[model samples]
Target: MLFRMRFIPLFFILLSVAAPQVVAHPHSFIDMKMSLSAKQNKYSSINYEWKMDPMTSADIAYELKGLKPDDPRWKQQEAIIMANVLMQDYFTDFYYQGKKVSFKRIPDSYHLEKDGFSLIFFFTASFIQPLPIANSHVEIQTYDPSFYVSMTYPNIQQITLPSEIAANCNVSLQEANITDSMRAYAFSLDKNDTVDEDLALGKQFAQRVDIQCP
Candidate 1:
């Protein structure tokens, strides 16, 4: 029941000068990976799983025009628009050995510090579609715990964004806004029990996380 917060403005659109509009939300990640184990001589790693919605070009147009889907501007930008829409699915629930591990996100304003696994959300120029990483985001690590943390398995594989799922494949363009959302979470298999064991470990992970989006 605990998750981390995120508000690191991964991308910047400057929707409008007078209004200073921005279209990026805090929950936008399309690519993901899982963790596996290798100590057993098998090629496997363990990582929490998460899914997101496919970004729609229509959404980007609306954000840029500062209007709803039916707005006239949407029609104008419809044909000449590029987008990097993302949606969420699930999160890592538990680890194998009951070590109790988890992750979360929080929201905040534009602020990014240089870190090892910083994913810079950049905005790309597509003829009709928008790439999600064109601007300047500060985070993107394929590893479950990212470069900041070491992997626990011997077959730890480095995950990354697949090309086929990219936005600038069929279209001809360069650059894009690279932004991401905040995810706050923790670990503990207390939920799988028969409702008799007290899940205190999960709460411990929550206690370790503090709001850093503000």
Candidate 2:
């Protein structure tokens, strides 16, 4: 069975005929890379790059095969995907001094490409107003609230900071510490199952990027 979601389509490649009860915690996976840039010590924008897993990429490619770039259907699909991302706030939550920060998506910055068997998505978001970084505490987390998709940064090296504030700002990646019980609960859910909205299961599994400038 195949299931489609906001960002990546979920492909059940490992479905078993004999033991059909087994389920996967996350239907799809995304490897994410991010970079933050500043303009004169003020936070300017964040650039995002996401690489979909091979199986999911293959499924997506097959689904959209034979459609040329100029095809109206192809363009429509891209628009739908972007609209979904916008509804989810681009899967990013940025906070400064405990207050949520506002950003505007750069429409032209959104694009997709293929890298080997993987599909890559690129986008940029600029702050509504360039935020001053001095003596500030910023927390950034990227995640899918539903927990249907798993997003991760393979390493801290995948996150970049601008040279202007690299010296004054200290950055760290804090991985999620999900308990054993939560893990079991997540595994118990089937692809068709939906958790309560307030649960926000994905947030519990998200890695936080903390930036402190002094």
Off by over 4 Å in 2: 1-22, 64-75, 105-108
TM, every model? 0.18, 0.84
CA displacement after TM-score superposition, residue 104 of candidate 1 (Å): 5.1
Model 2 scores what on Cα lDDT?
0.76
C-alpha local distance difference test of each model: 0.23, 0.76
Candidate 2 lDDT over 1-214, as tens digits, reads 2122344323232222223554656767889999987888888899999888776567556656787767776666566566667777788899989999988854436776778777787888888888888898999999888777788999988998898778777889999999998888888888768776787898898999999999
Candidate 1 local lDDT, 1-214, one digit each (tens): 0010222111221212222232222212323333222222221223332222223112332244335445565433332211111111012332222333332222111111112222212121111111232221212122222111111112223232233222321211112222221222221112222211242221221211111110
- Best candidate, TM-score: 2
Candidate 1 contains a number of clashing pairs equal to 69
